[model samples]
Target: MTKRAKNTPRWTAGMACGLAIGIGLGIVLDNIVLGIALALCLGVALAYALPSKDTQA
Candidate 1:
């Protein structure tokens, strides 16, 4: 089998958490549009900012 850069799926843990929290925050803040939009950005940034088990090929 060929070695891959990342063994994990595309959705990182941080992204998942961000989206989950985003939904809750969106409901609480009553701004789902903004919440989800911001969450996407937060997710991406957090995914990179936070460390994970994925490694280079």
Candidate 2:
């Protein structure tokens, strides 16, 4: 029997939320460069914030 990895719903949700917020802010602020930068930063930050699921036995 093989073990399956756990689903990362929180990470997905965080990324979606971050992207939406970044785009929305960029549009509101009327700056494409700022929006892209914000999105990238947010994406990286979110990715880093996600918990690692790798197990060592």
Colliding residue pairs in candidate 1: none
What is the lDDT for 39 in model 2?
A: 79
Cα lDDT tens digits, model 1, 1-57, are 997554443457768877887777888999999789878877777777665554542
Query: lDDT tens string, model 2, 1-57?
Result: 898866443466567667877888899999977877787678667755666455323
**CA lDDT of each candidate?**
0.73, 0.70
- Give the runs in model 1 whose Cα sits over 4 Å from its true position: 1-10, 54-57
Angstrom error at residue 35, model 2 = 0.5
Question: The CA-based lDDT of model 2 is what?
Answer: 0.70
Ten residues in sequence with the least summed lDDT for candidate 2:
48-57
For model 2, the superposed segments whose C-alpha errors exceed 4 Å read: 1-15, 52-57
